[model samples]
Target chain A: MIDFAFFLEIIPVLLAGLPLTLLLTTASMVIGFFLALLLALAQQGNRRIVIWPIRAFVAVFRGTPLLVQIFLIYYGLGQFRPSLQAIGIWWLFREPYWCAIVALSLNEAAYGSEILRGAIKAVPRGLTEAATASGMSKLLTLRLIVLPLALRNAIPNYTNEIILMVKGTSLASIITLMEITGIAQGLISQTYRAVEVFVAAGAIYLALNFAIISALNALETRLTPYRVRA
Target chain B: MTNIMHILGFQQGGWGAALLAASSVTLALSVLGFILGAALGATAAAGRLSPRRVPAWLAHVYGTVFRGVPDLLTIYLLYYGGSIALTQIGTLFGSDGFVGLPTFATGVLAIGIISGAYQGEVYRGAYQAVDRGQFEACKALGLSRYQSLRLVIVPQLMRHALPGLGNVWQLVLKDSALISVIGLVELMRQAQIGAGSTREPFIFYVAAAALYFVIAVVTASVFRFSEARAWRGMVHA
Candidate 1:
């Protein structure tokens, strides 16, 4: 059982880091969404030569642990300081924050690309045919017709992915970015009260997830305002 | 050339073999964890499905607590607090002091507990997916609970459960990587060692990532094949 008084002490301290946690989560999801869009579009069977490699890239990113990716990006790239200095990009690599963002964005992009691909494939063929029949070019048809339908079809699943990404942002704490989990870990180390600190952190995460869930549920209802009566 | 040779060569110094062995450790841990999770998951699923309030509440609390927290935090709590708890219990029995948990067992248990929460949900869904008519018919045929579960229910549930279990296996495999933070000599830890010694984290981390990718893809393919075989005669809606 958790002591509520101990939790009352820790909750405020952990909430101080909520801004950074939310920032990383939203920033990565937005950036990753765009990258995934471009990749999904580029890999939709036009460029066979590029398809295999892009598929391989997605596979590798999705397959490996995100923690390894973060460690590799931070420490692994730090080993290339001389080269980075020559290119004047050393400053970005020096900060753990930037590295965490890059790694999170890349990992989410790979997973998001798959989600987008599945949604795109599920688009009704006749809609695209109708768009094409109206003298629309491939690009225009994709932009106006396919993407909207795919996105609407994908909202439910995509919302779940967003929530997952929010949870995954906790891993960035390992590389010394003081997100919620990191702060909680620090508190536990100082106070030697693992249960209390962790309980507070878990409550914070559950609250955040609950908010996301309810928000998405409302969005789903509003998006499909017309419901069929059984 | 000498530098490359030194890095590659093994004389109680090189990391090539250590990293490979660590990868094997990761695989072994995941296999054990998955099995343990399956057992726990079944128990939890049964609890959730039971009419008794205590069992249902137990299952609910287990699923909610594990799913709500970050898996990394859970692992950290276990790594730090598990030994202390065990030693306390040992002291109660007049045993020796400080009963340390081995890294592998700790890692396995942490992963098992985390994955069990997910597996419970999957199993509950799969159980519910079984045709209601089948259950009614089993009862009408005078089958005992165990007999019905074994002959009429479990087979169908397993079929529905396989795809979900595949996803859980993947999750367990990736989560096993998180155990490296506790100084487990797993792939990520081995990569850290090689990185520190050789000052070439980029190469070794990339290599580790490659190995993980290979394992994930291979396991995914095997799961896909099994799912296909299991669903061969059935029509999917």
Candidate 2:
């Protein structure tokens, strides 16, 4: 009673959700990268006032689950429509797409910042001193020496985070976005073939992650030529 | 004020008790899932390390596929496929019926499957961290493979693996929230019920987040304590 034909049929329907999934992953990751840089930079500062709040923010975001954050943004904030409308920013929260992107980007930013911080901290202090001795300004030294090394160190972990974001977007289905998991759920109820439909959906995710992982692997190899065997 | 009192009350029309009870259930689900995952993980670690080809390949496939796929889909698959598999198994035993598993069992099954993939990597890495010279010493001492593993390998492997396991534990706790979609009355599901009933999604969701945070912090303290114990009597441990 196993149906290969049904598996074949659901592939196209699930792929329909792929664009939104990719869009959400790409958009949130891009936004998340900038926010994370801000966060990482903020935490690197000396001011206690600046440090404590950002520390708390990162801890709160990281400590809780992404599902909770999504619900808070979507349903919880949806409860405060009048207040938001009065504040003139209700339009952003009005759409589920925007809500998911906001929640996901926030969550990704928290983790991405941690990764960025670790990679930056791992850079050798002597390298910076040498660059300074060579008469480079702090900004030029940071651009030429520090970030490139940190980014190279960060590629693998950031790639892992992106894969995680791809998986995380599936939760957007709970809030009524018709992404892969969402469409898969619809098909399961309609077709009564849960196993096959989910298999197809899972395969789609696996393929997406594989493509991303391979691309990152190529980039990692390019960045760290010495680490590779000839 | 009355509505807040009613919501916070332990008596009739209140959800404080329900939410707290569900939090305990959430803890139980995570522990059970983690234990089940540890068992599967141990088997997978052995399989991957085995000299045989098939078990190694099978374990590799299991780890990759489970880790690569989204966990929510795994839960959904188990929820639906479990009953189907159970029903068919029951029919061969002359019972024509729906052998439905409780939601908690299904949730554990999903978490176990997902966490097993991760824990296998942790165990394999820990095993590799054990000095190769130590294993040769055991062989030179004429110790049986089982005795060497029990005496020399397992303890150090566990010590090395403690931090990684701590991470997997946190992952399990958060992943348990995903089980709520299957109608399990865990913290997230309880919050959903309250939010839906009260139309105050903010309070319930925030309350849920708080509870999750408290549990995570407390559990982390326990892990830290255990790690400290595991590292005792070392030069820099």
Candidate 3:
């Protein structure tokens, strides 16, 4: 009952969509990381006004599903086309690719900032105090001492978020970007073999995630040599 | 603003009731999936903890594949592949017509399977956190394995598992939105319909998001309360 030959044939076809999927993942992750850093750092300040808005932003994005965010950004924003055009940025909203990137990046920022905040908080106070006591500026201390340590601490959790972003790019198919899932769905429509197509697609995703997990595992080990058990 | 209110109002030509009903369907779908996941999780956790090599290896494969793959793909697989598999079984049983799985059942099964993978890990971690001395004490008391497990081990397991399971519940709740892809009339699909019909995609989508946020917030507090209750009278670390 299994279409082994057809599955083998479709693997190459599905691989054709891998570039777009990787592009979406990388673009969103890079953009989101910067935004998350800003949000995480802003969260460190004692001001209520800055902190509350950041908290609300994280809550809204984290509370709602990524599908809703994609829909809201893609179709929902389309309803305000004239205003968007007036702002001279309708071009960005018009493309499904950009919309997906924006939605994915925003969603990533929400979760990533929380992970980063925890990592930043986990950085021992004594280390930062030492940097400050050595006649270092706050900016210098953050750049030279706190950030590197916090980033290393953040790697494991951040790796999970990156995997999630990769998986999330699949939702872009709903908006018509031809990612791997999108290509598989297209093939299923033509071939009427949903099982084979999806299995092939799922295998591709599994392979991608395995690669990501291994690479991240290696990175984690490399960054934490001091923690290596004898 | 007035137009938004009117469109969302619970009056003639308004979609407030439909949205509310759809939100309930979303909630019901999530709760059902979560319940199903808990059962599967327990079984998988048991398999992982078993002394047998094959069951543990099988459990490991199950967790890795399900957790590593995207939930959307899992939903699609169940929705499409499940029907085909059911028809094959039906034919073997001498039925001629197709035996399609209902969309709601497929949604529950997909979410249950996906969440079960994560929940299994949570259970395994929580199980490890249970003190080894607790088992010794149970044995010292001459409690049977079944009695000790049901009365002693499970409670401690749950106390540690509550926080992790809370995170899993949030994930399951969000994942339920993908059920809309298979044409389930949950909150996301209902919002799509409302948006298409009214051409006010912004308002409907925003309303749907607000409804989701409310559910998430309310359920999160419920988890928090339960966690507190579970830890009541426990000594602080």
Candidate 4:
């Protein structure tokens, strides 16, 4: 039997973890977006040094599972504690929160860079030429004209990546962060009511994703008035 | 490099065999789930394309709910809730005992359900791309509904759907790593156990990651080869 009262009771308990989930998603996304921009731009250059390493990094991240990446960063990197300690950033890797964030950010960077690179490539050559004809430097053209247009084009795919990261934050629970899924796992152990508790937890995620989807749609519509149906 | 080989070696104390076995589990999980998903996806696609209002709306809801949610959460729900639902269904047949789904079955079902949503979209798109004239031609031939779909629509849909389905296969393969949470002895979980006992997290995880890469790259090429064959002689269309 479905228990409405029990579902209602767990909603507050689960919502307590909502902040951590939101924090993980937002922090990683903001950091990841900037890193993605760097990675995307690095490949546009003629130098193999920058492009090869970034390309390799993106491929490794995209090719493997995120869970493996998390383990590699969280547990595997911890094995090199002495070297990490020597580098003076061991303190960051020592904490599960930072490890989770780093893993998530790196994964996002991989996917986002590709999305951005595609968007940048898809930008019309004439637009960049027009920018150059207006007497702007290459850097100035990229900054003023190219990057903005690529960003607008990248929004839909980037929105998907963001939604993926939001779902991805649930992995943080595995490293002992009590995010929504982690909290649900805990509640199931305590109450022995897996179905009811998970149903409630799923509803919260459904609501969260619904908000994201609607916001992204609105932004997509607002930015692309040209896409409006006749 | 010698040290790396020692860690990855298959002899007594090495993780190579365990890692390989786990890779098979991962492959089987992905393939079986994809098969089930393809079937479900076809159904959902049909529902969405149906003229009937309810089935179309339900299919839309199915796609929205599965696609919008995190796959990790979906797997967890199925892992825990599926067994209970099974037990309840058992009760109607006078069975009183708890009916449980093994971790593998549960994982497969979860992957199937999640991938089905994406597959549905791919099928629907492919269905849309099937020339409208093809359907009319089928009707003109006095073909039955089922025969029309079989004789005319499906072959073209398969051609268009191959790439999208390939993408979904990669996703499901990566997502299979999540089944580790429920203690399935798939590659990721095996890596976790090997790493924990060996205290060589770097070696085991790196090995696991390498295996995943090999599987992904190889399978992707397979998809590409098949896709090429599928598109052969159809370029002008």
Candidate 5:
């Protein structure tokens, strides 16, 4: 009745696939951060052209489910094989890994842009005005004052976004990416013991998220030393 | 554009009708799950706020475990485990051997459990947001607890809870896609089926995404309108 041997066999296999999950999360977060930063910065000075398009883009990306987005990017785009081949980008489009990354990064950019915008808004107007009065150039003000404060303020929201990305990476499994959950599903097909294998996968995901949370919390404390002192 | 239109058309080969039906199923599942979650959430939220030891402990465990794990695992467990549990129950009740569990029921159960975890937090937060002084005032006026709750606490809690509940509904809607893995013919599953059958993965998947986008945008606007109406008289900065 016991399946201790089965558990032993699957744990290592599932762990092997965790790196892809982590890689997707990290790469997408980094890429999304840059894209989000650019969008957030662009939305600052312009309300007519730049802001509207970004707003629409963010709304579409954030409003819908990640599963739909992933399917659209992976299977949906695969329908354009001929066009992609014509454009010489079929190699990239043909791979599920690239599709997963693209979907995750675009999703994160929408959310990260919102967080960045909020952080920018939270920056006290008085400080920005004082910088302006002090003859600090716009670029210098952004580098020295605006970004540091915004980054500090955005830490909590960003942590939420990061953990969400970690969870969202599991959706890649639907597209045949053998991440942790995908491997777990495979194990279930092999063993027919749903509870134990899922529990193992859940434990893995929870452990990873827990580590991220603790690290982010420490970063938050380090970034806001005043809070630690208080 | 012509190819896109033809693939999405209502012809025998087209997936538009099938995907649309699946979207309806997704909507139905979300509503069912949201309602189920609200009931459980209310109970859990009350238990959490109760001045008792046992209920608080139960509530604590439920919240912690459900919130800590990924929703996908929760869904997978429900989808696979649900049939096993249901078949056992059916046999116990003297039904035919191996009573089947539909994917829709399984999907609803999964979505409900996950949404309940979130709804519990929302209700708990909303309960805390209810002004304590009003309860005191109602008591001063000699209103019974049920009457006071029905007249005062419930309305305020519902208003504050609306936005959070709306958020959980959207979350539930999106998460319904996960149930497709269990072979539920929801939107994503339908899209997958269309992709395989038509060999037009790109067209079908994009259409599915667009359908989801439309639903999300419309529902979000409705929730926003309700929030505005609910808080019409109150001043919020």
Candidate 6:
């Protein structure tokens, strides 16, 4: 008994939220990627003082649910508004959009750093040793030899993280961001056609993820030209 | 510090008891959802592995659609759509009014279906990872399919699936938090209520996060223990 016409009609409405969803995903992924790189690089050193704090950060973020993280950032931070204002950075915490971005980015960083760290560790040690033997410094060995291989290795896994971030963007709706899920929720309230509206919304997400998967697959093929095809 | 304790404490005005009760609800919801998911996952895995084309295609579609879409959207769809569908079914049976599903039931159903999709992949992978020779030996020993599956294949499959299942369990536990949006009064929802009533969101949320972390850590250790036991007497390469 689904209204086919209604399903077609809501596509344009849901598409309106596409730009914000893309923005949230891209912005958080970019920020999170850099933070994750920094974290992974820091952990390359065996210093307990440095790695312990990062380990704790990853454990806490990965252990708790992202919804709790979002609520903690948005409403919980309001509890410390005066102190934040005094510190001159209350502007970042003031908007729900910013709060969502912060939480999403932090969450992505925890997961992404682990993926990147594993990739980095998987790089062949002989290659790096050979690079160092050829008059390259440790920094050069990492930059010229280790990083490229690790990044290529990391792409397949990072694609999953990216898809996850795209999915994670839907949670922004809960904090009133007017994203796809937000608009769909609004439409459902008005029309009481939850199934149709959600089906349309889910279609949009499915399309987005499919595109992402294809692009990453293409990237993986392009980067690993040396890979043997079975 | 004392004020923080007073608010979270088990005293008259404290929210400790309420939060504790809500955590139990969260645990129950997740455990039930996970068990349901495991059953669905096994069925879906069987479908995927079947020689028939239709079931394999249907199972593939289920995995792709569920895995691609957000869990929040699925929960919302089920929460809103279930009642509507139920009412229509009720009307067909001559029972008139809107037949709404309870929030807890909806939550469990949502989590079950979503986790089932992921668990299907885990089970399929584990099935493939079972050594080919074992199956050959089972056939050579003149064992029937059901007997071999029950006695030989399934145990090894469970052993291989343990790590993946542990991951899915954590995912299901975390997803139970989203059930709060539908107002199930679990840990997340209880924290929200306490935050609103007491106007102390930071404390309540921090406390809630700690509780979730503890649960995750404890369950993880249990999985690790079982994994170690499962690996007992096995030779490692």
Predict model 4's lDDT versus the native: 0.90
CA RMSD (A), model 3: 1.8
lDDT of each residue in A1-230, candidate 5, tens digit only = 76788778778988988999999999999999999999999999966888899999998888788987887877777777899999999887789999899999999999999999999989999999999999999999999989999999998999888888988988888889999888887877566577888767877877888899899999999888787863
What's the DockQ for every one of the candidates? 0.66, 0.73, 0.74, 0.72, 0.59, 0.82
- lDDT of model 3 at position B113: 94
lDDT of 2 by residue, B1-237 (tens): 787667857898888999999999999999999999999999999999999999999999889888888888888788877777777898999999777668999998899999999999999999999999989999999999999999988987887999999999988998999999888999999999999989988888988999999999999998899888877876782
By DockQ, who's the top model here?
Answer: 6
Q: Considering lDDT, where higher is better, how would the candidates rank from best to worst?
A: 6, 3, 2, 4, 1, 5
> Which residue pairs clash within candidate 1?
none
* Weakest lDDT window of 10 consecutive positions for candidate 2 chain A: A185-194
Q: Give the alpha-carbon lDDT of every model.
A: 0.87, 0.90, 0.91, 0.90, 0.85, 0.93
Instruction: Show the colliding residue pairs in model 4.
Output: none
- Give the CA lDDT, 0 to 100, for residue A13 in model 2: 90
User: Which scores greater on DockQ, model 1 or model 3?
Assistant: 3
Q: How close is every model to the real structure, measured as TM-score? A: 0.92, 0.95, 0.96, 0.94, 0.92, 0.97
| Poorly placed runs, candidate 6 (over 4 Å) | A228-230, B87-99
C-alpha-based local distance difference test score of model 1: 0.87
Q: Mind giving the per-residue lDDT tens digits that candidate 5 earns over B1-237?
A: 887777888897666798889999988998898888888888889889999999988987787667766677777777666666776788788976655468888788778878888899999999899999989999999999899988989888888899998888888888888888878898888888988887877777777778888888788888899888878888898
Tell me the tens digit of each residue's lDDT in model 6 across A41-145: 999999999999999999999999999999999999989999999999899999999999999999999998999999999999999889977989989998989
lDDT of 4 by residue, B1-237 (tens): 877787678988777898899999999999999999998999999999999999999999899888876787777678667766777899999999877679999889999999999999999999999999999999899999999888778988888999999999989999999999888999999999989887989988998999999999999998999888877878665
Q: Write the per-residue lDDT of candidate 1 for residues A94-116, one digit (tens) a residue.
A: 99899888998998889989999
The digit string of per-residue lDDT tens for model 3 on A1-230 reads: 77678988899999999999999999999999999999999999899999999999999999999999999999999988999999999999999999999999999999999999999999999999998889899899999988999999998898899888888999999999988988887887577577788778988888898888899889988988888888
C-alpha lDDT (0 to 100) for residue A211 of candidate 3: 88
